[model samples]
Target: MTMKRIAPLIVSLMAALVAVLVVGRPEHADAKADANPGAKDVIVHLFEWPWASIASECTNVLGPKGFGGVQVSPPQEHVVLPGAGYPWWQDYQPVSYQLQTRRGDRAAFATMVSTCHAAGVKIYVDAVINHMAGGASTGAGSAGSTYNHYSYPAVPFGNDGFHHCGRNGNDDIANWGDRWEIQNCELVDLSDLRTEAEYVRGKLVAYLNDLISLGVDGFRVDAAKHMPVADLQNIYSRLNGNPYIFQETIEGGAGEPSPSEYTGIGDVTEFRYGDVVGNAFRDGNLSGLQNLPSQMLLASGDAVAFIDNHDTQRNGRAKLTYKDGTNYALSEAFMLAYPYGTPAVMSSFTFSNPEAGPPASSNGTTNAVNCSSGWACEHRWRTTANMVGFHNAAYGTGLSNWWSNGGNQIAFGRGANAYAVFNRGGTLNRTFSTSLPAGTYCDVANGDISGNTCTGTAYTVNSSGQFTANVPANGMVALHINARTTGGVTTPPTGCGTVAVTFASSTTTVWGENVFVLGNRAELSSWNTSGGVALSSATYPVWRGTVDLPANTAVEYKYVKKNGSSVTWESGGNRTINTGSACTLTVNDTWRS
Candidate 1:
């Protein structure tokens, strides 16, 4: 049989295996291999760590901690705010996509990528693609690329590449209610690119593809909600077809674009989490914690969850701050223990003030991340790192037998492999159902288990699935079915015998549903379908017109948009098509690429 004919059968068999695991009550089963592409549980947001240091951290710290990946600072060259003491926000501005920056030169960055990938830790680049540097006049970026927004001679980005200020003007972003104006207009005097244009898309793709070629796994699209949803979709389609695109849409309250707009295309940062955790911790209301797992269950699986990010740490008032020290550690520990949207824990250094930069050299380069300089390497905290391992081990599991007092104590089992509890109330004793095979397990938060026994405060689960333990005031506890005295499962899942493919692109307009048409005579050869048979496209390269996809089976696909020949793929390698969406001759891949 041809490759096309056999591909569907392979996918079908895999899907069936996954279904049985998801629905059947199997004993001590591991996570399904193809569960979620980026669903390894713990992700470390290595704020402001230079590339070289990050590469080492991934190898020595993150890899051993069982973290799925690391979200690095913006890798692109940005404006250097010397007056601000090279504050972290300086990197938020972009002059060009040169690999040369404070993080390290191109060579250093390449080494970081290769080194991290070798250790099984994926690198998610913080891509500031929405706008250029906020205040740039010298045309020369830190990477030595000369770029004047008016000229941008080094990048050859002339007036044609940018969007002109609207009638409202550059600083009028707060006044303009339309998303187009927010995206197209200059953000705080920054240079805004016209992502809809073909020439612009090509340049952005060239930069992103370069990173992908260097082994970068995905992107955290900065200021995503500022751009049009359609535009982002188009850009994503053109770039690396379905590369990991996580949009930074700060949806704080009710009046913002729902993560749904971007969820169809790629994972989006769920900013509400900061507020949820902040309010819960500050108010000392553990009942507030009860709502979290349920809320996360409602979130799309691709949602990127975080307790505190760089922006929140600097701007949000009620949000968790590094200054809080121990409180921050406790909050992060709870975040990791609870299964939510894919979690990316914040790691930071000490700063006297919010505007302070990382420990820096007189020459202006960012210093290494250190705890002694008052930097709170929250990831290094025992509870935090142990939870990271717990998350990895509980990867495809759902919350079962959840127990919460509607106050300071909460506990739940992740699948059957792990169980955890948090005590925010004053010290107390309680008996709860753990659902573990009646045996002794180490409380991972205190210490790990060893040789059928736990080291520190080992708890025994009676035949009734009840275990008694005391949760000290402002403390936490965890017990894993399988973990060593000093370790838990540290390996991420590698799917069974399937080669993965990803798409990288600059803008979403080219292959967006709104842009392409059936009669437009678009070339659709770069796209392919996996679950069933026969996939075709119309004018839009990203649109998968119709196919005979298998019922209740998962599929993966990629697209190549026409703007200077850009290619994009799904964030994860697969998406399940429920039986309701499948038919004999027609099934639509409407869940974006």
Candidate 2:
């Protein structure tokens, strides 16, 4: 998130005028690698998360759920402003390119990259290359490197590397219309780097290349609009590989640099996406969203869409947050369900004060993530997390079977792979036509399918491709091929001779202990405690997972709660199931006290 919210009233007036002007969408960059390297397209920004916590989440949560990538906070040495109660923006102020901060040291950063890669999830670093620390910040950085205005000795950037654009008494940006001042002048008194200078470009390239060498797959270039597009292209050309680059170019008025100017090089952040989607959901208007792509600043392929980022969430621009409850969840679900740009989901910590930092120690080092407490963990919401599977299953499919009440109720489909309905008003009772084949699907938005049982609601599509449902107010029902509750046909098709067994356990757990299942067969780890198949808590108090067990086999399994090395087995004789010749089966069990 960029701090470009200066003179918003003026910018808004100009933006209204610029919206009508037609401009050809720039061709997307051919040199860029896949923004999401995994099979899934959704990426989550774990805002202000510690390196160790992020590594663990990648293995246990993101990778297992098919999340493609994680966008981490800046890993470079940055200003530490303890006097100001250690504001979150401090991490955006770079003191040097050294990979050391409250998050972790260079070694920890390297470990995080490799760990996430092993889980098949990519890491995109928030690259702060357009500037250094603010003019007022003068102190030793998080890495113990001293830094002052225009003189970061750790990065060896002397005063010559900065631009002293002679305008506005303090050389800070004041005119929102002047393109030159917007790019050359300091933004809110941050020491702007002269990106046009070769020396400065070389230093930026080195920093990015260093991260690449450590296995980082991409970058979220902060304050990208403040740099010349040519300068960015030149720097990108020198980087090791074709890393995914999404520039932060907030859509501005006609005179200022437009997001379109930056899309030629790579995908640009579509800030308008949040405002449009947020307001629609907030105002209970579903009809306008049908024209969502036309209302955006960039083309779908050249844009990175998001509802609210770290900055927008605090700046009063966000129409909804975790505080908005159901509306926010619906907004995220709509973003994933709709075919738009690559979606970036935000996972933020709760904050009362706008400038307050994340949950941290006395010394300001960010603490490990505790989703039940300080963190919102919105990305892990059953609706949001499960929508990722819907998005993936619906990939390469086009919109079909569109239905709407023309007000607050709507339903749509992604070809034959997925279908969804949203009701922001009263109970919506109607039959929905879809392209999906005849079968049973779990309503992922409300619950999940474990084995053959649906935890929330189950809807069966008739051979004619239609189902009747009563979607409640502020409620949603989404289904996809990946979450089919019956039959052996999965999104990626399980091979023959194996049956899908979904294990649903109605058991509670302490904070640390998690529910897992181990059984007599190899698929169930042969009662090996270490090899227990972990179940998902997305729908808590009902841990569930689907395992492909051999057909025509008798399996004995027991649910256990594991906290580290300790395992608490359910107090019961072994529960048995006969995997008959049927392709799918479900075994529902309650933990015996």
Candidate 3:
């Protein structure tokens, strides 16, 4: 079958299936492209936008702006929170797997997906499977499906799929130390699911496969860290292969699952990158970004880097303040230029209260996301948007000719295809080696190309590979060789391939035992000791153990703590592994792997 013939057939099939499943029309081809990767560098998170609005944005703004994909809010039926003023978290509550929510119904969602796909912009759904609504009595969701905290009638999940909250509603995760409880226990009063069950896995897979059949490219698994690694692996394996799966595991420090656990199944969200970039930009410390290369090298392939996300924006008591729009723009632009994990930029509207929803009307309907509506479309800013073009032009490239003042000024070449300078200090006037074939190129940060001429006051790159440009305070400059000129370096090196590592232990405990315990200190280790190497620690109550490993190597090691006069491991002999290079160990049974 030729590409032309296969395309229509696929669309027709999706339309028919979606029509039969629910009373709705199929999404247009352009909406489907929101998750599929095209020859672009940007993926806008169209928060709370309806399918119709999204389709329009693709044709009017995203397509012309050079966006590769769009991560849409959860499309599944969710809790309708009227008390919280219908906040965005309402989507976090899963009433059913049906494609119906605040954004649109099943038909509208399908149409949006197909429409985006037609425009060469992929659609990635934010899959929230960790838990149901925080606190809700009635269970008729936005899709009209009946659900209860103890049971979901539409999906028909029973007690086997849930875990009861122990005294104080903690479930004793600190004591029992079981993966099952962590996944099945309530999170912030939200009902969790038992993903390990084959039936549950099948349902999840079916929902995702339905989306894939509708032309979605991947999913953003929300609250993934709270789930079991094995269960996630199982669910992902059952879903359509080749779909982009980015798990949300907020591991900031050295230890924890390290995003490596889920890398085999799909890319994991790198939450720490947001903090690093946000802090560096806000403080005007460009040198803090110099260590990005090191972090990228450690991230391997599972890193799904991003700026401020929904949770972080809601929880202001966190790192990298994103309330400031200027700093947010600088951070996003920097991420676009830096060679890091698979990048996903945050496109959000302005909000005064942390729990506030996107710009909404008096009737509680989400307002259309437009620049004039007080929504900070940071992704559309001149500097940020141009950097997206630069990123697309320099895809698969590595950082070369890195030049930094070790302070508030930095510049680097992206495989000679593009070069960028970030000056957080005062105005910057520097002549840097672009490493591009001598030719004039358009400064993407400032302007566009038209009829072989760079329009606007965009800085120009001379034929000598030496371009002197001034980046005003809190501003940046990026020059792309392919923006207006031809014949520049296009190739990049292929680094070492990745590896998959799993950890197992003799104990079937929910949470692993505390292997290390000191006065006011405790440590835990969960490694797969059956296949990989083992880790040993000294028997010191107040002492901690540290381990270092290579990139892309998977090994399991157990933890041992110092007792009064002896060393002891977790009671269940719990074992864990580290998959990446950089990791840390802290107290309180926390293995910052």
Top candidate when judged by TM-score against the true structure: 2
Q: Tell me the alpha-carbon RMSD of every candidate.
A: 14.6, 15.8, 18.0
Model 2 weakest lDDT span, ten residues long: 4-13
Better of 1 and 3 by lDDT: 1
Question: Residue by residue across 1-593, what tens digits does model 1's lDDT show?
Answer: 00000000001334334434433332222221112344454678888888888888877877666676788887877666565577666777666678878888888998997676545577788887766654334535677665544445445555656677665644435544555566666666666767665555556666776676566667888877767776666556544323456777765334445556767677777767767876676557766665574554237476777778776676654377667765676778777766678787888877656677787787677646444565567787788887887776676777777887877677788867778887777886888787666666677788754454555787777777778999898777787655633223422222211111212222245332222211111122223321111122322333322211223434433332333234334344433323232112223333344
Ten residues in a row with the worst lDDT in model 3? 1-10
TM-score of 3: 0.72
Model 2 residue runs over 4 Å out of place are: 1-39, 488-593
lDDT scores for all predictions? Answer: 0.60, 0.80, 0.60
TM-score of 2: 0.78
lDDT for 50 (candidate 3): 67
Worst 10 residues of 1 by lDDT: 1-10
Pairs that collide, model 2: 451-502
The order by descending TM-score is 2, 1, 3
Compose the digit string of candidate 3's lDDT tens values, residues 1-593. Answer: 00000000001333334433542222221111112232343567777676777887776766555676789988888776665676666767777788977777888787886566545466788887765544346647787776665556666655565556574454423322444444555666676666655545556767887776565667888878777777776666544324667777766333334555656556776767877777788788877676675654236355777787767776662355346767777788888888777678776777776667667665456646455585666677776776776777677888887888888888888876788888888888778887776655677677766546566554545667777777788777777765654334322112111111112222221222223222111111233221112222212222222222233553434544333345454444433444442222222343322
Clashes of each: 30, 1, 55
